[model samples]
Every structure is written in structure tokens, then in C-alpha cells.
Target: MSEALQILQKYWKHDRFRPLQQEIIDSVLSGQDTFALMPTGGGKSICFQIPAMVNKGICLVISPLIALMKDQVANLQKRDIKAIALTGGIKSNEMIDLLDNCQFGNYKFLYLSPERLQSDWILDRIKNLPINLIAIDEAHCVSQWGHDFRPAYLKISGLKDHFPNVPFLALTATATPKAKEEIITELGLHNPKLFQKSFARKNIAYMVFETDDKLFRIEQILKKNPQSSIIYVRNRKSCLEISTQLRYLGFKATFYHGGLSSKEKDKNMLLWMQDEVQVIVATNAFGMGIDKSNVKTVIHIQLPENLENYYQEAGRSGRNGDKAFAVLLTNPSDIAQTENQFINILPDKAFLNSIYIKLCNYFQIAYGEGINEQFSFNLNAFCLKYKFPVLKTYNAMQFLDRQGVITLSQEFSEKITLQFIIPSKEVIRYTSLNPHDEEILLAILRTYPGIYEMQTAFNLPLIAKKSNHPETQIYAVLQKLKEKGIIDYHSRNNDSTLIFNEIREDERTINRVAKYLENQNTLKKEQFKSVLKYIKEDKVCKSKLILNYFGEKTTEDCGICSYCITKKNKKTNTIPLSKEILLIITNEELNSREIQNRINNKSDDVIFAIQQLLENEKIILKPNNKYILKL
Candidate 1:
């Protein structure tokens, strides 16, 4: 067996490598910086993991989402491979201990959030470690012009200054031509080889339906598939409403949004993953790092803001190489709503200034003084309190982020807390009945006085270790205590922070990147508008339209699109409204509405017949309200 295949079987329990995956792994192993563009479910992780496992030193994986980090670490440990993650959710002592393990323990992989890159200690520690390779997941975030840009990702190139010999692997599921170039340039890869898999999914049929009744369309889609499916919406309220409608239709459906507590999110996800729930109605927060293989369909209830987001979210279906469907339901009204959203997103200079002033007022902090201060933002609540337009205000804040004035974290962020629900006296009584938990319970009560007083929010894992209890058992005990009316437990959430990171924003510094980003936005807007063109175009095949948009040069039509099906079975164009029918209607001289009622045919067909008669000079639209024959 080949060496790569040998490692794949021993670790991942697979005999073969996925398409283009082996090529990527081989490039990174050869000490060359690699750029990989694979569609979703193309096995992007194994590209880095296989090479990391074969190399001598630890691989540093820089990711933006904490949930993704946790997932990868868990999967790695399941194979008895040593992996660790450094994130903000843990206690400071725990973070230090984790860092210690990375430095001393024989760990093969270390996953970290991009925000940690700005820390002086993390950089210093990384410089000392014998790092082998650096992998940047979702590498498109490095480009400010990209749809999902992150400021912390800009600092990733600095690692090369410390470890000049380590090759970097940048991987992403979706990126435009512009984003791909920016990623390669920003990373300063040493003659990096780019591996690109085709963005086309042949087995997945794509279609767009224009309808005034999107909710009805969603119901129809669910009824047709009736299997594992995901419905994507734009916000939290819609997620719940659509899920409720699905359940009313007698389908097992669940809802997920950023607003849910971690416990709630986990419970919903577990139910769906276990096949106990047949459908999940969710916002954009639902798909990141999800590995379900049987999602037979993905339906978008509302149009996404851009194509990159739409493509990424829609690409979640058909992972198993089976025939799946992706549908987008919209109407004239939705187009207007989508345009208003984009127009509201303009980075107006004056609006940005007002936002700067509001931040100072909202936080009650002077200029250059809000550093290290964390505040919660409720968009509607803030707008109502300040009498500002909520939609426009959010757009202005995004512009401020681009201007380097503040940082905005859109995910539902909150202070995390882990506390015992029982009082000291009740704990003593319960411990006497359950001696087995006595030692662990006493240790917890002694180590965490703040939990007893309800003074601060704590992390549960830290408390579990301090109490010498299994993490899973501690969670169950906390739940049992809460059910007994001992105390209430609340989970953590993601929040946005406005940091005075750059003390000042000079126009020259901001305009350089802003101009580039604006052009990129223009291109994306044009791309989304073309989907409407495809819907109305009479001659173009749907599959050919999409492939051409992605710059595929093709003359032949795909034999599977709606256009192909319609072309293969053409209908005769016979007019049922004959001259005799028109003559009877003319004799009556009915009004346009009454003429349609007398015809006993579709109003559209009647209208078409009237136009043909007028063109042939057989009839005329009279001055008042009747059609008269030219004779």
C-alpha cells in the first residue's frame, strides 16, 4: 500500500482519499505552501490532517469559529490522535494549562480562533514551538473584499516572519476569482501551488421559482422530499415561524438560530443528527461545520443577500453524491426587499460619523476609552431607544468596521456562566443521601464560592476538573438540581464588541481597502441579478446559465435542467379562441373584463386572441370600452 493510503486507513479508517484531496496533501508534504479550493463536502480537513500526521511537528490550524474548532478536536481525539484547542470560553488558568500542553505534550494538532493571534503571549508561544505547517480554514475571510471578512485573519501572515520555513495551507469552500487572488497574495506563500476542484455539482438539480406565496412553496418542497432537508431563512423569527408551519403540516421539524442557548442548540442539533427530527429550519448559523451526509434537499425561504452566501448554504445538500435539489423561491416583492437591504448597506460617510458618536453615548465612554469594555447590543432595542432606523444603522456599523473604527461580532454573544443550582445547606443534605457524589460535590462547593453567591458566570469544564467529576456527570447533576427548584442555569452566547483597536481612522488608510471592497460588491450584485435573468430567459438552459456565470466555457446544454425538459416535449400552439368566438363577443361589445367572463377561457388566452385580431385589422379597441370589427 502507498504511504498516504496507509496513514489514511490507520487513522481515518478509510482505504481511499477523496477527489483532489491526495494532490493537496502531497503538495503540503513537499514543503510547498498550498491553496485548495474545494466545494463543500470535498474533504478539506483531510488535506491538512493527513500531511500533519505524517510530518514531525504540530500543525497550527487558524479558524474563525469556535464551534468548528471544538468539532475538529473532538473528531481527532476519537481516533486516539492528540489534539488541543485554545479558545476564549475556557478560564484563564485553563487556557494557560492548554498552552502548557501544546508546548510540552506530544500534541499533533492545535486549533485556534483567529482573535487569539493578536495576543502577545500566543504569538510568543507559537514562535518557540516546533510548528510544521499552518492551515487557514475558510481562507476567504482574509480578503476584506470577500463576503465574510475578518480583521484578525489579516495578522496570520505574521506567523511566517517567525517560522519562515513552515509551509502554509489555505483552504476554502467558496471564493470568487478576486477573493482567490487576494488570499494567495496576502498569505505570501512561497510559490504556492493552487488545486481547484470544479464548483459544479452534476447530481444536484438547481431551480428558481418566482411566486408570491413563498410559504406555500416551502410546504410543497417538504411534501415532495419528506426526507432529511434543511430550510434556510434570514433571521431568528423566521426560523421559528417556518419550523412551526412545517410541524403544522405533519412533518417532524425543528428550528435553530443564534438566539438559542448552547444547551438548546445542542439539543436541537442532536435530535436532527439522530434522525429523530426530519427537518431543520434555520438561519445562516445552522450550517457551519455540520457534517450530516443525508440532507436530500436545501430550500431557501428567502433570497440571501449575495451569491457567495447563497452558494455556500445551498451547497450543503447532495454531499453523498446522490440526486438532490436546491430551490430558491422569491417574488417581485422579495427583489425589492433584497435591493433595499443592499442600498441600506451603503457606507455613507455622514452616517458612519453619527454611528461613532452613538457608540460613545451608548457605552458612556469617552473617545479612546472604551477599550477592553464589553457591551451587549440588541439591534431593535437599541434603535428604539435611540430613535434610529435599525436596518440603516446596522449598515453604518459595518462600514465603521471596514473603516477600522470598531469590531462587530454578529453572532449572539453573551457572558457564559456555570454554577451549582443547590444552596450550601441543600447540597449537604443531598450529599448525605448520595455518598458516591459526596467527594466531588464537596470539592465543587469549596472551589467555587462564587457559584453559591451567584456572583459571576463560570465555565463548567473548569468546575468539573476542580471538583474531580466527569464533565458529563456534572452536567447531569446540574440539570437534576435545577429541576428540583434549587437554582436556575443559563448558558453562554456570542456577542459583538466595539474595540477602539485603531485609535484613529485616517481616510487614506480606509479608502484603499474600501474602494476594492466596493468593486467586489458590485460584481456580486451583478451575479445575483443574473439569476433573475436565467429565470426569464427563454432560450438559455438553466444549468448552462449557472456554469457560464462561474466562467465555464460551454456550448452544449445540460440535459437535466428545466429548460432541457421543456425543450424535449414541445406543445402545439393552437388558439382555442377562434374567429366565431371573437365575433360573438364583438356582437355583444362587452367590456374588457366582461369579454373575458363571456369567453369561458383563461383571461390570458383571451387577451392574446384580442391582440392577434387587432394586428390583422379585423377588430379595433373603441374609444369608449368596446372592440369593433374593421369591416
Candidate 2:
């Protein structure tokens, strides 16, 4: 067996590599630059990890997501591999100690966000490490043509000058041919070995349904599948609402979003991962660096802003290779909703400048000063003070974040989590006994729908507002209840820290990056056009359309997608039985349309009955090509 195979077996316990994984690993091992354009679940991490293991030195990985960096580091640590990630919230002393550990402690993998490269001290220290391979995940971020372009990623090529001999491997789940080329050019990959797995996922049947009633379609899909699933929404409110609705309809579901405290996220993710919960409804922040092989379906009720995100989110399903589904439920209003959410709210130069100035003033930064200054920015308070629209102001702040003018550490947020320990009757008795606390307890009851059933995160300020009291008073009441063993509760402020990356230059800051920002805006518009076209165009195969979008060409249609199913139904004598019925049909409902619409799904029974009836001549095909049943 090859040494790479040996490493894979030792750590990952896989007998062999997936298609193209070995080749990419071999290319990097041979000291050749490699570009891997694999799908989301195609196991891209092992390509760099195994090579780094085969060699003696630590592998340097630059990623765009802090959550993914931390996740990879934790996974590697669980495997007894010494790895370090320099994500947000690390103090300077802690960063120095981590760097020292990497320099002398023989760590195998070091993952850091590309934004960290802006620190000269970090770059200088990293240049001295015994780096063997450079892995750039999310390589599309380096290309301005890419859907998620980050300006800091462009600075990664400078490392090439530092580590002249170390080979580079770039990986991205979704990238266009143009973006691929730009990634290669921007990173200065020299005669890179390219390995691209086909964008087609044969086991996944992509389905798109045009329905005004999305919740009905979601219910229908879940009832048919009834397995582990993820429902992606565009907003946090929708996540909670959908999860509650699914639970009301008798499905075990939980909600996750960025606003959830770390403990809440971990608890909810664990419940879903362990199959204690059958479904997890969440926003886009839920699925990075987490893989569950048994997820049978991924439902997107809201049309994603772009197809790249949709493909990645939908690809989370069916990883176990049994037949799975990727369903997209869209209504006519979704287009306008998408545009207004993503495009119309996009910040222009004027908005960007105004927002930047407002931020500097909000933090009390002096003109031409405030370089390297950081502040704990309460987004709600800032928006309220300025009377700026929340979403638009947040978008502008994100624009500034992307342009490197400010570093917004949104990951550092907190929320109140609580649940009633006593039964409803006991809680009511306690509330009556404690009349002074009754108002706050009642406010909690009115604010949270399932406080007695399960623990969940809540908006503390909102609860306070509901109780017509100060937030401190609400916190004190919850604490008193906890002490009395009436309820379990905790609360923390939800504040995002903002670090000013550049000196306070009001208008020039926005002007300096106006062209780049405008170009990105245009790219977003173009991306939405493709998204709209893909959902609206039912003539082309959905799988083929997605495949072609990533520059892969194939002549044959995937015969399992929604388009293929619809095309098959167009032929003669194809009974329009619901997929729910195709799975199982009971004896009593064999000839009943109403029951057939809600039949049990057991393949063998249905197939066996068909064979028995055909052989006994109880069923016959007539000359008109209709199946006639003679009892």
C-alpha cells in the first residue's frame, strides 16, 4: 500500500480515497501546485491533511471563515493531531503563545483566516515556521470574479515569495471557470495540477416546485421522507418560526442561527446530529465544517441569493449515498423578496460613506486618528441612535468589513437561555405565591412558546420590553427564579466588536474602494440573474443546469431530477400517483385515490402485489394502452 493510503487509513480510517482525492494529494506530495475544484461533500480537507502528515513540517492553511477554521482545528485535535487556529477573540499574548507553540511544539496543521495576514508580525513569525504545504480553502474568495470575494485573500500570494519551495494546493467547492482562472492567477500557482470532480451528484435528485404555499410543500416533503433533514431559511425569525411549526406538526425539530449563544448552538447541533431531533431549521450560518451522513433531505423554502450558496447548502443531504432529496420551494413573490433583501439594500458610495462616518463618530474616534482602535458596537443601539434602517446599516458595515476598513467580529455574541424546571401547574402556583415576580414570569411565558418543554435562547431586551421594565430588572428576576429552583436561566449582552483597520478618513475611506465595491455589487446582481434563471427555467434539467453553471459539459440528462420526473410523466399511461403512494400501498387503499394520496411506502409489497395481479390476469393492458383491472 502507498504511504498516502496508509496515512488515510491510520487517521481517517478510510480504505481508499474518493475520486480525485488521491490524485490531488499525490500532486501536492510531489511538490507540485494543485487546484482542486471538488464538490462540497467530496472530502477536500484530506487532500492537504494527508500530504502534511506524510511530510515532516506543519501545513499552513488560510481560510475565509473563522467558524470553519475553528471547526477544522477542533476536528484535527480530536484525532490527536496537534493543530492551531488563530481565529477572532484571541488576545495578543495568546496569539504569541500559539505562534511559539507552532514554532517549537511541532504542530502539524495551522489554520488562520486570510484576514490575519494583514498583521506584519504574524506574517513575519509564520515565515519562519517549517512550512511544507500551503493549503488555501475557499480559494474562490481570492478572485474578484467569485461570488464571495474577499480583498484580504489577494494578499495570500505574498506567502509564495516567503516559502519558495513549499507546494500550494487551492480548494473550493463552487467556482466558475473565470473565477478558477483568477484564483490561479491571484495565487500565482505555477503550472498547477488541476483536479475537478464533476458537479453532478448522482444520488441526489434536485427538485424545484413553484408553489405559493411553501409550508404545505415543506410538510408534504417531510411527511414523504420522514428522516433527518435541514430546512434553510433567509432570516433568523423564519428559522424559529419554521422549527416551531414543524414541531407543532409532530416533527422533532430545533432552530439555529448566528444569534444563538455558543452553548445553544452546540446543544441544538448535538441534538440533530445525534438523531434526537429529526430536523434542524436554520439560517445560512448553520452548516460549515459539520457533516452528517444520514441527512435525507435539505429543503430551502426561500430562494437563496445565489446558486453557489444553494448548491453548497443542498449538497449537505444524501451524504450516506442512499437516495436523498434537494428540494427548492419558491413562490412568485420570492424573487422580489430576494432582490429587495440582497440587491436593493446593497450600500452605494453615499450610504457607505455616511455609515463609515457614523461608525467613527459612534465610537468617538477623532479625524485622521482611530487606527487600530476597537469598540464593542451594539448594532441595535447604533441603528436606533442614528435612525438608520437596521438591515441597510448592517449591510454597509459588512461592506466596510469586506473592504478592510473595519473588522467586524460578529462571532462574539451572547443571548439569554432558559427553561422552566417545574411543571406548568407548579409554575402557576409559584407565580401566585410570588406576586412581585409574577409580572416577569408572565412576561417570560408570553415571550417564549416552549419554555416548559425545552430550553431555548431568547432576546433579553425584548423580554424586558415586554415586561415594561429595565433589562437589569428582568435579569434579576430570572436569577431569583433560578435560585428558588423555579426556572433555569442566564443572560448575556449581545454585542459585536468592531476593530478599525485604518485611520479615520471619513469620505476617502469609501472612495478608495468605490470601484471594487461597485464591481462586487454588479457581480451580486449577475449572480441573482443566474439564480432567477435557474429557478424559472424548467425546460433544462436542474442538475445539468447546475453542472453547466460550473463549466462542466455533459450530454445526457440525469434521469432522476424533478425535470426528468416531469418529463417521464408526460409520456402515455404514466399514472400520476404521488411519490408518497409509490412507496407503499395498503390492501384497503389499493384502488382508492384518496388513500393512495396518503399510502404507506413499502416497495416490496407494492411490487409484489403488481406481479401477483398481472400473473393471475386480474390486471391487463388494453389496446388503448390503459391498464384495465378485471375482478
Candidate 3:
């Protein structure tokens, strides 16, 4: 057996690789820079992972999502693999220790976000490590044309200069031809071998419904498909509203959003993943790196910002190759809302400048200063102080990030850590004096072995369950313990981290990337138009439209999509519409409008038959817009 295959089976417990995965792995193993375009759930991680294991030195993975990095690291550790993720908000000493571990501690995989590349200290440290390969996940973000563009991705190419011999692997689930070319050019890949899996998903039946009553339609769909499902909304308010309504209707449902605490998010996600909940209504924040294979349905309550986003979200269904449904519920108003939300309200250059200036003021940084400085940013406080809209301010910050002016790390869940300040024996004596807090403290000590040595994540729910106490009581006990100098605790539920990429500047900085901003706006307009076209288009198969948008040409229609199904139903109605119209006209010399009103068929079918009759001289149209049978 091949070394890659052996490692895959041993660690991942898979006998064979998915389509195109082994080939990609071979390219990496052969020391060739490779670009891989795999769909969601295509096992993209294994392509780089198996080869990294087969090779000698450590693999450096540059990813965009901290949650994804943490999850993958946890999973790898569970399989007895040494993996570590260096994300934002870590202390300087902790980061030094992590880097030291990566260099000396036989760690096989080291995952870090692209934004970290801005730190010269980090780069200097990385240059000393025995790095074998560099893998970039969500590689499309390096391209200007990609949906999720990040400026830090551009800095990834510098690694090539640092480690000239190490091969590079770029992987993403959504990328167009334009984005693909830009990724290669931006990353400076040398003679890269490219592997692209077909984007067609045969098991997913794409359905779009234009209904006046969306709630009723959703209910109908949920009733029909009573399996694990995900319903995506546009905002947090809707997430709560829909989940509440579903529960009221006696369906097992939960809600998730970025506003939820990490503990709540994990608990809710665990419930759904364990089959304790039938549905999860959430915003787009819910399903990144989620590995649920049995999700039978994925429904979108509104049109997404772009086809790439929609495709990725819809592709979440049917991952196990079982028959599943991807349904989109929208109306005329939704199309308008999509345009307004994504395009019309987009931050202009002036607004972007205002936001940037306000951000500097909020952080109390003067002009031409604050380079490489990081701050714990409170987004709500900033918005409230400046009286700016939250969403628009956030978008402006993202634009600044794309221009390399700043790095925004919005980690929804912070990692809370606690360390015992007093000796274990002293803690035992103190807890004995305060008998009410004894159970919780003992639970914490029993659950986490190194709590006295180093700070660990604070899991209130787990501690509460173990101590047979409510979460409120557990929190009270922890607070009391902290007040008495028994332990030191830091909570990660609030605040985002921001790093100034360069010296603070005024509006001229915006001018430096003016052309890039213009291109982004143009891309946004085109993406909105494409989404609108997908919704209004009735002559083409829905699946075909999506495939074409992704640069895939298909002459054969997915015969099961909503469009094809509607057309098939029209053809199989078993009654000839022309004859039906003629029969109605024979009884009375009626106008075309009257004839249509008298028929029991669809209005479009009736109008089509009338036009055919008029063309064939079977019926005559009078000047008063009336139709009569010719004798």
C-alpha cells in the first residue's frame, strides 16, 4: 500500500480517497505546487493532510477561519496527531511557547491565520522552523474577484521567499475561472498542477419558490421532509423568530447566531448534531466547518449576496450522497432587498474614510502611528459612540481589511481561561470553610487536571452538570472564588481584536487602493445581478443556471429541479389546452379575456392556446379584443 493510503486508513480510517483527492495528494507528495478546486464536503483537508504525514517535516497551514482551525486541531489531536493553531488574542509569552513547541516538539501540523503573517516576529520565528510544505485553505480569498477577499492572503506569497523548496497547496470550495487565475498569479505558484472536481451534485434537487406566504411554504416543506434540516436567514432577529415559530408548531428546532455565547452555540450545535433537535434556524454564521452528513435539507429564507455564497450554503445538503433538497424561498420583495442590502447600501469611498478615521479615534491612535499595534475592539461601543449603523460600519472595516489597512479578527467565541492562584491544599482548606462552593470547585479540579498550573477554557455548562448545580450558581461560585484570590479567570465572550497593518493615515490611504475598491464594487453589482437573474429566470433549468454561473456549461438539464418539474407538469396535464379553449369558445362567442376567465386551466396555458388558435385561423379576434369561433 502507498504511504499516503496507509496513513489515511490508519488515522482517518478511510480505505479509499474521494474523487480527485488522491491525485491532489500525489501532486503534493511529488513536491509540486498544486491548486485544488473541490466542492463542499469533498474531503479537501485529507489531500494536504495525508501527504504532510507521509513527508518529513512540519506542515504550515494558513487558513482564514479561527473556528475551523481550532476544530481541525481538536480532531487531529483526538486521532493522536500533534497539531496546534496559533490564532489571535494570545499573550506574547503564550505565543512564544506555541512557536517553540512547533519548532522543537515534533508537531506535525501548525495552523495559523493569514493575518498573523503581518507580524515580523512571527515570520522571523517561522523562518527557523523545519517547514516541509505550505497549505492555504480558502485560497480564493487571495484573489480580488473571490467572494471573501482578504488582504492578508496576499502576504502568503512571502512564505515562498522564506522557504523556497517547500511545495504549496491552495484549496477552496468556491472559485470561478477568474478567481482561479488570480489565486495562482497572486500566490506566485511555480508550474502548479491543477485539480478541479466537477461541480455538479446529482443528488440535490434545487427548488425555488416564489410565494406570498413564506412561513406557510416553509411549514409545508418541513412537514414533507421531516429530517435534519438547516434554515438560513439574513439576520439574528429572524433566526430567533423562525426557530420560535417552529417550536410553537411542535417541531424540534433551535437557533444560532454570532450573538450567542460560545457555550450556548456549542450546546445548541451539539443538540442538533446529536439528533436531539430536528432543525436549526440560523444566519450564515451557523455552518462553517460543520461536518454533519445526514442533513436532509438546507433552506434559504432569502437570496444570498452572491452565487458562490448560495452555492456553498446549498451544497451543505446531501453530503452523504443521499437524496436531499436545497430549497430557496423568495419573492419580488426579496430580490429588491438583496439588491439594496448588498449593492445600494454599499459603503462608498467617503464613508469608508469616515469609518477608518473614526476607528483610529476610537483607539486613540494619532496619524502616522500605531503600526503592528493590536487592540480589543468593542464594535458596539464604537458604533454607538459615532452614531453609525453597525452593519455598514462593519462592511467599511472589511473593505479596509481588503485594502491591507487593518486586520479584523471577529472571533465569536472567546477562549476563557482560569488558573488557581493558591495551592491545592489551601484551596481545599478554603473550600471546606465555604462549604456551599465546595462542590463546584471540586468539579472544576476533577474535570481539568492542569487548572492549577495553567489557565484552561471555562466550560460553565459542563462544570454545572458535574457539580449538580445550575449555571447561575456555578458562575456565582467562580466569582466568589476569584474575589477570594483562589483563582484568576478571564472571559472571552465579549470584544473583537483589531490590528493596524500600517501607520495610521487619513483619506489618502483610501486613494491608494481606489482602483481595487472600484473593482470590488463592480464585482458586487455583477454578483447582485446574477442572483436577481437566477430568481427571475423561468425559461432555464434552475440547476443549469447555477452551473453556468460557476463557469460550468451543461446542455442537459437536471430534470428534477423546480423549473424542469414545472415544465413536466405542464406537459403532462393530459388535457389539450387549445381544444379546451376552442370548446369554451364554441358555446359562446367570447372575448379572449372572457375565454381565459371561463377556463379552469392556468392563465399562461390559456393565453398560449388563444394565440395558437388565432395564428391558425381557428379563431378570429375582433376589434373590441374579443375572440370568436369561425364557421
- For every candidate in turn, the CA RMSD to the true structure comes to 13.6, 8.2, 13.6
Per-candidate TM vs. native?
Answer: 0.74, 0.83, 0.78
Q: lDDT tens digits, residues 49-102, model 1? A: 999899888999999777788889999999999999885546557877887898
| Over 4 Å off, model 2 | 411-490, 572-631
- Superposed model 3: Cα runs more than 4 Å off: 372-376, 402-404, 411-493, 574-631
Index of the highest-TM-score prediction: 2
1-631 in candidate 2: lDDT tens per residue? 9999998898888898989998998899999999999989999999999999999989999998888988889889989999999987889899999999999998999999888999999999999999999999999999888988988998999998999899999999999999999999999999999999888999999988764346756877888898999999987768877998888989999989997878989999999999999999999999998789999999999888888999999999999899999999876578888888999999888888888888888888999999888788777667756878878888888877877889897743336678898889998998888888888878889877787876666666566667778878887888888898978777676678889999998878778888888989999999999998888887899999999999989888999887887677456332333333333432322432233235453432333334334446655433332334554
lDDT of each: 0.73, 0.84, 0.84
Please give the TM-score that candidate 3 achieves against the real structure.
0.78
Candidate 1 weakest lDDT stretch, 10 residues = 501-510
Native-to-model Cα distance after best TM-score fit, residue 29 in candidate 3, in Å: 0.6
When summed lDDT is taken over every stretch of 10 residues in candidate 2, the lowest stretch is: 587-596
Question: Over the full model, what C-alpha lDDT does candidate 3 score relative to the true structure?
Answer: 0.84
